[model samples]
Target: MCTYLKNMANYKHSHLKNKSFEEIQMLFNNTLKWIESFVPMDTELVKGSEKVAKGCSKRATYKLEQEDAKRQRIEEENESVE
Candidate 1:
């Protein structure tokens, strides 16, 4: 199917080289209709996709503070050496 679309696109580009933008858009939309004929329409909204934990924000802030403290310590040590 992907190969077919690629070949069709090449064919369209070769044949419609002189066509206007509107004509090209219409041809592209018509080509997409073939995909719709093969694939079923997904109308339902996806539910319950909770990716983050409850304390994720707190943990992230703590991690950022730890990294900042480490960076500050490194800078302080470098300044003392100089």
Candidate 2:
């Protein structure tokens, strides 16, 4: 009886292993199809994000330039006083 139960357990384990592999393959194929359907939208999203990043960088650069000019003006006024 114990041998029979052990064999049954082993059989179930083997069956489960086979099923898992098939499930994984199915999931991968489905994901590929989904990505293919939305490829254009994904590209647009990536481009939009890049544009936003560039705009932020430009704004930061402009702010730094204004700050540097203000500092130079202050230094010039101080030198004239001396």
lDDT of 2: 0.66
Error of 2 at 5 (Å): 32
Candidate 2, poorest ten consecutive residues by summed lDDT: 1-10
Error of 1 at 42 (Å): 26
lDDT of 1 by residue, 1-82 (tens): 3344457655544566676778767767778886565633343222222225436777899999999999999999999999
TM-score of each: 0.36, 0.49
lDDT of each: 0.66, 0.66
Q: How far in Å is the alpha carbon of 15 misplaced in model 1? A: 26
Candidate 2 C-alpha lDDT tens digits along 1-82: 2233225323344433545656645645655576566646458787998899999999999999999999999999999999
User: lDDT at 78 for candidate 2?
Assistant: 100
Alpha carbon deviation, residue 43, candidate 1 (Å): 22
Q: Which portions of model 1 show Cα errors greater than 4 Å?
A: 1-54
Which pairs in model 2 have colliding backbones? none
Alpha-carbon runs more than 4 Å astray in model 2: 1-42
Q: State the displacement of the C-alpha of residue 69, model 2, in Å, after optimal TM-score superposition.
A: 0.3
